[model samples]
Target: MTRRPSLAGRLSRALAACVALALIVMVVASTLVMRSWMLANMDSELHRLSQRAGERLDVEDAPDDEVDTDDDSNEESDDDSDDDSDDDGARTTLQSSGRAPRPGGPLVPGGPKGHGFGGAGIAEGTLQYVSEDGEAAGAVVSNFSVTYLNAPALAILAAVPADGGMHTVRLKGMGTFRVTARVVEGKTVLVGIPMDSIDDVVLMLVGVEIGLSLVVAIAAGFAGRAWVRRELRPLGVVRAAAADIASRDLADESGNLTRVGEETTAGPVEVADVAGALNSMIDAVEDGMERRARSEAKVRQFVADASHELRTPLASVQGYAQLARRDIGEASRTQALERISSEGARMASLVEEMLTLARLDGNRALTCDRVDVIPVILDALSDAHVVAPDHAWELGEAVDAPVLGDESALRQILTNLLANARVHTPAGTRVVVSVLRSRDEAVAASAAPRGPAKGGGSATGAQASSMITIRVADDGPGIPADIRDRVFDRFVRGDSSRTRDGRGSSGLGMSIVESLARAMGGSVRLVDSEKGTVIDVTLPAA
Candidate 1:
């Protein structure tokens, strides 16, 4: 089973952090903006109140009775006007900044309201204003403390520059406040408004934002889980199909596990494409396997036919040899003994070739090792001389030819080629075995049919090449153009009707050569030649 990453685990963790961070930013920003708006409103209101009070002051409409016109004429209306101005300022202070008189209490305790601009205020925590000279301007002692002004809300107040617009002040140990101080007539006019309403709104906004973030995170996690499952469904189907196909051996004629099911297309594109492609590949493999099975059945029938034909001649030869041995006549005994030996050898050769073909048809592993081609050819020629005494065997100069192959199989290849030449060539015919390094000739030998001439009889002096080739040629009746390709097949011969008279030649030599060459990761084929049959054996050099 294939293990996949958990979608919920990844999505949930990622979304939680993202949503929480976003909500925090939103809360902080909204709170700051709301607090600023509230302070601006309060500052505007205080400015309007000051302007109204300034507009109400009248210079010309001074009380005539209250201003004493003195006998000293130089003390003009200006002197009386200044005295009237001082009185109006004191009364305005008592009305605006003075605390409401307590019942049965003395009013304006500081010597009966002698003031130009004096105000009373409630001080709490860090909410205190300093004048341009840096001295405390308003009330000195109250609920707030100036030392502890580092809280987040209090930091917002400290952030406001002394020269900037109206801003709110939040004390660490006291409630938030909106404070504005401006210079009026060379004195600071300070006004403060509390920010409780704005604070409540900000708190509400924060709660709503956090709740929405949580909802979004939860919804996203659920959606991701649903999407992942839907996307992986087709892959699951494909996985099951592959597992079933691998476990089944469909070579049995019964069509049991051949069918693969189609899946729905409501998933990811990659999964759908994989399933479609896998099904097509499997179908093609199954068809090819079925065709191979039919071909193997045909090969078995052919083998049975060939075995019957070979066994009959052997049985007859053996019976005659037994009778001749029992009679004890010299001539009869000699002929029977010769027939028996020839028949037995022929049968053995046929059996050996047949077994080689059978090995090729089965799952046989070839043992490949480094073998020197030049020496192997020399050894094969020495063996061939005994078998073909009448034919003039010429051994050419040996070249350094190395190959990776089974040594026994390489020798068999040489034996088959020499035996083929001996069987086809006439007595006293010249047979040449040349060893040289030729790149094109080696390639052409493995690609084309065997010829009776060495590399098309064009003795292009040996060229330096990567591969080594050994050509065995004979000046005999060359194979016809049409049957040359089939010469390497089992039971096929140059002249099929002219059966050998028990000389151990069953037309299986070339077949053994073909099979052996293939097992060594090489091949044997006819080289184009004009004169006689020439078989070139090419092997890779070490």
Candidate 2:
């Protein structure tokens, strides 16, 4: 199966693009700067060379009678002389002895100005001069007095100048150049220089730029992949941990995953937060598992206890009925009939208690009525006194202690607490029930007692005008600390062996009390009894 791209992949791609773009920009900028610097240096060198060549073309004296009208600052009569010849095969005027030196004389003194005798001076067959007026007698001379260039430089030189216009040219086998000139004193001096060096430098720089761009692209791609991997490592851990968890593993207390553990919280903030969420889910799952287990166990135990409680009476009734049917005397029939009636009555009582538990489990809507909490406690105590005359029962009342709930559930809760106190304690143990307004002792009993040994029999009770609390405690052994929190679970009595109670105590009493109190928006809890287990019942004030 094709997997979808992860965040890491996308992030790496984006980072790579950014890095590549930045590198490209830098390379282009550097290349342009290098090319410009190289070109400028070449141009400066060319200009310097041209200046030196122009210096060499100057003459020592001015020609007379052909005064350059453009500027006449130098005007002197020549005494006598004729040496150089013009293109017409005519002898041209040379510098005479008496002629004044012209202003702006020779750019440099003593420079060559001539045509070859019987042949024109052309450097290496490339540099040549042609006149504008026309060649005279197989000779070409420009109107400008002087011109010079290197024929070997022709291949690298620019295009030949047109009259007075500057032009650039690329020679046949050399690089490009610029050739230019302006007429000075009725003479034209052309200068040209090769640009091969500058062109070579530019080409080299272009190559470097392209190479750097490729290198940068490669480097960015590798860096992007590494960065993506580093950033995504945490998320990978989360995925693996999640996959390891399963439904069956939810109840394994030792292996269960929770957010509060060091492993989950030890990482980066994002990972820690994710771990915390997982821990919360784990906690909820564990609690649900515990509750479900208790519920199922209670259901099974209930079925067993009901069978045991009703079976004895049911069997008795069946036997008595059978005996009555087979008897011939009225006395035997009447005696069997009496035994049947007594068994039926016992079954009836057991049924009533079972029905009460069922009602509590169904979480039916409760009836709200103002009940004096003191009276409720006294009533429960009075019933306990009658049920087990062997145990001592004590009661306390709080002034104006009132509550709102189903009167019957409250009565049952108190009855169950007293009954638990009776069953868990030995005969003649003092069972104190106290009720008081704003009594701190009663409030302390809302928490679970430590245990049957260290935590039992130390239960206390307290009360507030706005909330009523009652405690039923004994002097016998209390609940164990380890299982104290679980005592309120359905069908979970302090004793487990069915043989301990030939008529086993149905463990749903505490469960019924807890469920009923919660349904009525109140709470029932165990407290540390002075010598035995103490239970505290709290309800909303009327």
Candidate 3:
């Protein structure tokens, strides 16, 4: 795959392109304006020269001056005499300053005489004129000398329409000129000015503009790149943080958290906003990973504890089976068989509890129905009395609190709570089972934030005063204080001993109770009691 260019590079290119385009437009407009101004100045000068030439032409009215034009030498002599003895004594004379006019290219200057009249703009340039008829013309070099090249030059000038509008034309030997025609009396006189000066100035202006534009554009490109990179520095820090997270060994469950610091989150508002979101995302990921690590640890402990639990019953069943095989006597064999059967039943119960907890953790949806928890509480109390008659079991405040839950799960929850009380307490412990409405407040008819479906979380409307609370309390030695906080954790019991009351009580009983309660959108908690264990199970009212 082709790698894309960086943002800095693209932005720099765009900035340079914009700068260059603007400069080009400005340069083009200025160049055109300059050329137009130069042309206008040339036109004005050409018109002034042509008008002066026409005024001079009307001085030569003698029939001899017109006839002598056929001879170049005689024409020059007549022109000198006419210029020296002008009829008005104020003759409008024309002259060349430096270069002599080309051979057959004389009698062209139309300005009045002298170095004082010709400045830097017109000095050393040729001035040409055409007669009224198409056949005659004259030129004068800047030295006040007259010459003739009237054959082709006169024909080129004769084409001028005397419209006073300037037009450009090139002569055979002379350079390009801006020429115009002015009619005086009945004759047409043409004036021509060279185009070299204007062209040189315009060319230089265009050349300088192109060079300057390139220099400025290149500078802008470099500066823009640096600026863009500077502004994006915070983003680079964020990327490094992400990369550090991505490269970590998350599968190993090490739970080393990662995050970008305040420096990375500090920048322009736009970048800062994105960085803030990035930090939040990092926090979420770290939390999830930490939870996963804790879950894995719990899974390992569960497996080990399960192995220990099943091993005892298996060993007992094996030992009893071996004893029955020996046949010490018929009565002894019969006792071994009964013992094996009891152990097998206990193993089956443990396995079933594990399966139920697993299903609840998997978030399997159960049949929800309105369950009258009062009967369930009484049933649990009766069963507890029959099993542990030495303990006084009674129902306390059995209210008409019907709850929305799976009935079987609710029975199992109550059964587990009562069983815990019976198994852990001494022979004379007083146990009370209660089903009462929540006293906090009425539940709002709206959804609320919840946790995993299995356990350890409350559902929406959990705080409603109308909720059902099933609390099983026993007046006996309370739970060990150090383990009270985690009493509901799997395999936790009042005592660490594997067997209780000569029976293996699967520690999963409380865990299952919590899981089932939460799966039904309820929650269970171990309440702090002064001298005994008290557990409260709260469920949403139907």
Candidate 4:
């Protein structure tokens, strides 16, 4: 299996990647802007310097007749002997003595005009000028003087256009400069500043940006990871809860209902939601386990009850058969034989009820048709009257409650209910059977509980006026509160408190009624009544 990164790690990586990308973009944009701004300032400076130099050249080199017309200002009439500028704001007019300056000579720019260049922090390679005569001159700030350029440097500057627009060019001996050229008094006047300062500043700025961007990206990664993990701390609580459940011993008889703490719900909404979902799942699992435990307990009780019940009949038949073999005279032998046959018949009846319950529990299919419950009630009442003539069997408040169910199953339900009343109550107890047409809510006890579908499943509130209720009630002592809830459970019989009247019951009677009713899309429930037991069976109306 491919190993996947943790949520925290993956999220941190994404955050870091985004930070790095943003920083890179900023660095590139800033570098370009800074470089562009510096070059613009350099171009402006070069333009101003070139114009100043051209003005001076026009005055010193132009012919006497041409000087006045070419001059932008007549200020060039100052004494030629004082060829330098000073702090008094005077600008210089260079002569160069019409020849190249000697190496290490007195500073030619030392006069008021040239001294103007000395202050103001003007440095070596800060200014250079190439004239029309194929000669080059440059200021060496360090030496506080001006010197002629070698032939190669002069040749490079001479090639510059005199259009007065700024340009960058590398000099043959004096490094690179941004320069402009123009004709001044029949001589090409070139003036420029070197490019070294701008290059150094821009380089340092780029270096700083790259280093800062990397630091920010790395810092973002670590900080983001911790924040995300704290926000999702609830997830760890949920995981621990799950692990605790998993570590349990969930055997057949074990019942553990451990749960996660409320702290697990404290976090971001998404984390809280996940923790809440886990709690819900745990609740469902606990409910299922509880049901399973009950079912298992019921099964054990059922097996023991069945064995005890069958053992009684088998022992009786065996004992009587042995007695008959003794030949204790004809009447006694006949009585033993009869007793054996009677016990056999009772056992057969019990087995039949058991088998019927098994098939009903299996959800056996039934053929359904409209059944008028009044007729079935009357027929079952007549039979109960015959079985226990001492009991007062009567029909009460009858209605034409037609239901869609198996006729035989409907008859069986009423028979079982009447039998329970007859056998459990006193001989003179009044048993009344009633029928009514009712709404689903009024008779919804007949509808099956919702779960995995049994065909079309149970009735709903939308099925208004769709239920037929048949109630079998008696005026005998009511069932004890303790066993009333479980009266319909298989093999669960009540004590004498319900006036069971010393009668024996298989206890499967009510369970059978319940199963058959539910199988036919109906339900059975015991109602709280003023007196005696009131068992109501509801079915879907035809």
Alpha-carbon lDDT, every model: 0.58, 0.57, 0.71, 0.71
Regions more than 4 Å wrong, model 3: 1-14, 40-54, 57-161, 166-176, 179-192, 229-261, 268-285, 385-394, 398-401, 427-430, 441-467, 500-504
| Model 4 TM-score, all chains together | 0.76
Clashing pairs in 4: 84-111, 84-112, 84-113, 84-114, 85-112, 85-113, 85-114, 162-181, 446-522, 446-523
lDDT of 1 by residue, 1-542 (tens): 99886755576567666766776787788778876786667677655643432332221111222111112332234555665543221122111222342211112333331111222222232133322222112221233311211223322433455442466565544566666545544433344455666678777877787788778767776776676666666777777777888787767632444444555333457766787677777777777787788777768756775777587667868797677869587888888887677776667767767787788757477787888777877788888888778888888766766777889888878887887787776788888888767645434323334333443532232232655666888889888777876777667677755355434456677877776665665556577767897776655556
TM-score of each: 0.55, 0.56, 0.75, 0.76
Say what the RMSD of model 3 is. 8.3
Q: What lDDT score goes with residue 315 in model 2?
A: 87
C-alpha lDDT of residue 198 in model 3: 85
Worst 10 residues of 3 by lDDT: 88-97
Error of 4 at 330 (Å): 4.8
Off by over 4 Å in 2: 3-13, 35-203, 223-295, 328-371, 375-395, 417-433, 437-467, 472-507, 518-535, 540-542
lDDT tens digits by residue: candidate 3, 99-166: 22222222235644422112113445655564543224445354544433334565576677788788
Report each candidate's C-alpha RMSD, comma-separated, in the order given: 13.1, 11.2, 8.3, 9.5
Q: How many residue pairs clash in all the candidates, one count each?
A: 16, 29, 20, 10
lDDT winner, 1 or 4: 4
Question: 1-542 in candidate 2: lDDT tens per residue?
Answer: 99999777777778778877887788778777876786666456545543443444433222333222221233222433222212111222223334454432222223553422112232211222222111110111222222222222321222354354445566443345545544444434444444555567767876777687777777777788787677556666666666666534554552455234575467778877887777677677767888888888878977987887678778888998998889469999999898788677757756876787787678678898987777777778788888889989886445566777778888888887787777766788888887543343333333433223243232344344456656666777887666787787655777764323333455667777777777776666676555577676666677
The segments of candidate 1 whose C-alpha lies over 4 angstroms from its true place after superposition are 1-194, 210-249, 252-310, 321-338, 350-386, 389-392, 395-411, 426-430, 439-464, 480-483, 489-492, 495-499, 515-522
User: Which model scores highest in lDDT?
Assistant: 3
RMSD of 4: 9.5
